[model samples]
Target chain A: MRKDSRGFKIAFIILLSVLVVVCFLLGNAKGTIEIGVKRIFEVIMNDDGSTQRMIIWNIRLPRMILAALVGVNLALSGAILQGVMNNPLADPGIIGISSGAGLFGIAILVIFPQHQQFVTIAAFFGAMLAAFIIYLLAWKGGIQPIRIILAGVAVSALFGAGISGTLVFYSDRVYGALTFMNGSLSARSWPEVQTILPYTIAGIILVMIFAQKLNILILGDDVARGIGLNVEATRLSFTALAALLAASAVSVIGLLGFVGLIVPHSVRLIIGNDYKYMFPATALFGAVLVMLSDTFARTVLSPTEIPVGIVMAVLGAPFFLYLLRR
Target chain B: MKNDIIMEVKGLSVSYKDNKVIDCIDLAIEKGKIYCIIGPNGCGKTTLIRTMSRSIKPQEGHVFLSGSNIFKLKTKNVAKKMAVLYQSNATLSDATVRELVQYGRFAYKEWWKGSYEEDTKIVDWALEKTRLTDFQKRKVNTLSGGERQRAWIAMAIAQKPEILLLDEPTTYLDISHQLEIMELIERLNKEEGITIVMVLHDINHAARYADELIVMKDHKIFKKGDPWTILESDVLKSVFRVEAQITKDMDTNKPIFYAKKVI
Candidate 1:
């Protein structure tokens, strides 16, 4: 049975790799002008200055890469948060990481348009600050998931209020901030991908290295500590990493939810929770989920594309209900 | 610092809010003996064992393993000499038995390194000893309470600990399952020479298995001695507030008691 499960996990990983490739092809080929597979590969392999090649190079490809990176960052962040909180439902948004980032991103777009260049930095700072405060509120000589969740919900609501207050007063500037709030990827390109790429790389590497300790932690606190883990230390460091990954993705894409929730939750439901296996699997599948959903969002309304965040929320909220019922 | 004294608790106290659960307790744990702590509800049996295991930090004083202050040592270093089993095995993980057992090597592992041959061998030995090899593929949630309890013991023993502190290891199991767990624990103590300190609700089971019994009352040691000495009517009446009828087991020559009433 063990051998069977291992084989299945391996097959599932290979299948995910194939799906990512398929999404790349589907995403790149189905954009405006509808290039053929042969032409897509031709453009990818050779960068001639033709219009289709220019379209793929300048517009379609960067958005696809950024979507894929956002998928990775949010999914892995959710997976790490789940591990730290010891709840399969835990994600960046549960602890106000994304909300914090959204508040700051909106604040910059409306309040400090002059400092637009540092919007990503501001979002990242807000995410860390909110996460820090939540952790502080949760820690009463020891950390408990119940306390963290309660504190997080309160923190998220406060930051969410900050965002609404900003929007209510700056109603004239709401258009500029609306796309940021809705997590639109309309004009995102190479610069956006480059911004999020470092965090995705760093997050994946760190999670992989500490995967075993993560597994140890899910054994619950007494066992984790009895087995030699510094439970509080492990939880704090991993949670900080979760905030970092979520912040990077939120800084780029605005307030996207459910990529964090759905991808990791589904991956764990399919594959088991072996962290070593879960991390890579979630990364690949996160990329696939975002790419496919973003593709659907891009084409569903005939170029009147809704933000991917809207697509995710519409899909994610019900899936979350399904998870709770299960 | 005597060679046989495996652990020592000195002036240790623990409290939750205004209530002092363990009030300045002191005790010496000798090597390779099975010790059972028993008392009425809220008498601090659980807290005392938890403190001894270093899972609960006391507000005052120290618990010494060997001669060093246990709290002063790194948790991993403490784990090398002692292992603890908590009451509940509830977890969000669907990790299999072998996977759960594999983490017992965490105390001995390097994060960047692969767990080598010895780790696997020890894991295999723990599985074998606990008779969990057949069910090693099963998710921990799927295991029976008795089986899961054994699997937890398997994980603890994988540490090769010198002392095992268990908090009500057989609390909620059926009679047969409880005996199975007790017999397994007895085997671990007798064969491996692991000093065992456990909180048990069943005084009769404690009398049957323990080399010594520690009776607690009001967060302090009421009495502690051999079961034969500690299970007498007056002692039982004094500490447990119960009238006891005591007799010797014919087969094991161990004292057995039946509580008549709260007096």
Candidate 2:
């Protein structure tokens, strides 16, 4: 087990380094643009009256950071949710948090046009509200994992209808809403990154603090309670933290599905179920996947970027099906 | 017996929604003795055990552990005093034998304390006692039902509590495996000076293994005494609604019961 963990850590580091290089190259490249790895590094560092410097620093850097941040947040949230619920398929998007955010984002754009920050605020609230509803529905003295997922599906469908209704009614706002709803890293700036970073950081820290409790919780509620953990409280807190991470990710980048679900499950298969390793490893793996996927999205259709969510879904859906089969 | 009292319950009752699962009852468990509670299905034996272990709260009454109210005490402190091995079907996956055993040390561990030498030692000792040292690295999912039960026992043992409560520990095991676990538990009580309180469905096993027997009927204690006193034909017929022949084993001189048919 020790040797396996060591090998995983080494491979993970190598993968992360490769992702960084690929992200740097894709982010800096433009029309008929080709730059060496050494020059790319210098351009990122030097800021010496170079067009590459401007491209690296201003536009691509924030996008890359957003991609990494959103990736880590979503994947960690998924991992934590799976552990707390003790279900391999449990992820923020599948459990209605992402859909709720999408619905609220649409409502804000359609109804409250003047409040520009409405999308972010509404998305966060929507995610929290959806989670709260699931909690209440599942609470019959204590929450059950199957009930939580069922409630999530029910709530997700309800909010999903709301989103579709808004989209049909306000067709004129379709372009803006559609772009944001589909999840794009195209419009990211420093301010957007700054806004979502605190919540992501805070949520990740909370997950780390509660990671050990989550491990105990996997043994089931009775054993968890017997072992002296406040099982319900710990589960609720982790659920909220997971929602916070998902909501924050949605607020900044819109609905990026499958990254959260796929990254953590894949990591678990590789690393085993120990959350101490699973949590950090899932975060890194998620970030790497999104960084790589975003690079693909930008370069594949160069100058006209396909949404990163599209790339993720295209890649993630097949992998998810394979897992289901397995 | 009074001096040996390690756990005391006063007017304890537990309810689920409108239905009371464990009616008002009192129980006192002695130190270093194997006490078994036996009853028909849904007669509150498991619920009573859960209440005693503090896994479920009593609706009306107090459970005192070593003369202190259990509910009022910190859960970690309670965990340090008593360890519970609930029914073995509780969903756990992919955890190795060593990993599962190490969980018993959670209450003893501080937040900043990483897995230490002492934790490993306790885990090793538990695995040794359960005779699962060879299977220490095996995933819990890979173990047979008997080995899994032993693993759970190892986990409880790793807690190193003065009192151990088991809820239907031998439910799914083969007869031989059941005997192995019962013998192991009996040894723990006799040699390690740990108080053993268990819920058993089999009257014969209870009579054979338990030093003291508690027969619960209709969510209350119908009788409590030494197994030799409680495992009589009349008591068996009344509680279990079955005709039984009671005799003494010539070798061990313990009460042995053979159920004939429903009364």
Q: Identify the leading candidate in terms of DockQ.
A: 1
Assess chain B of each prediction and give its TM-score: 0.97, 0.96
Clashing pairs in 1: none
Docking quality tier of model 1: medium
Query: Which stretches of model 2 miss by more than 4 angstroms?
Result: A1-34, A102-122, A140-143, A164-175, B89-92, B113-115
Residue B214's lDDT within candidate 2 is 92
- Cα lDDT tens digits, model 1, A116-226, are 777777787788788888878987755677788788889888987898788889988866467666687888999999989988999989999999889888888888999
Scored against the true structure, residue A317 in model 1 reaches a CA lDDT of 88
TM-score of each: 0.95, 0.92
lDDT for A294 in candidate 1 is 88
State the displacement of the C-alpha of residue A294, model 1, in Å, after optimal TM-score superposition. Answer: 1.1
Query: How accurately is candidate 1 docked according to DockQ?
Result: 0.77
At residue A7, candidate 1 shows an lDDT of 82
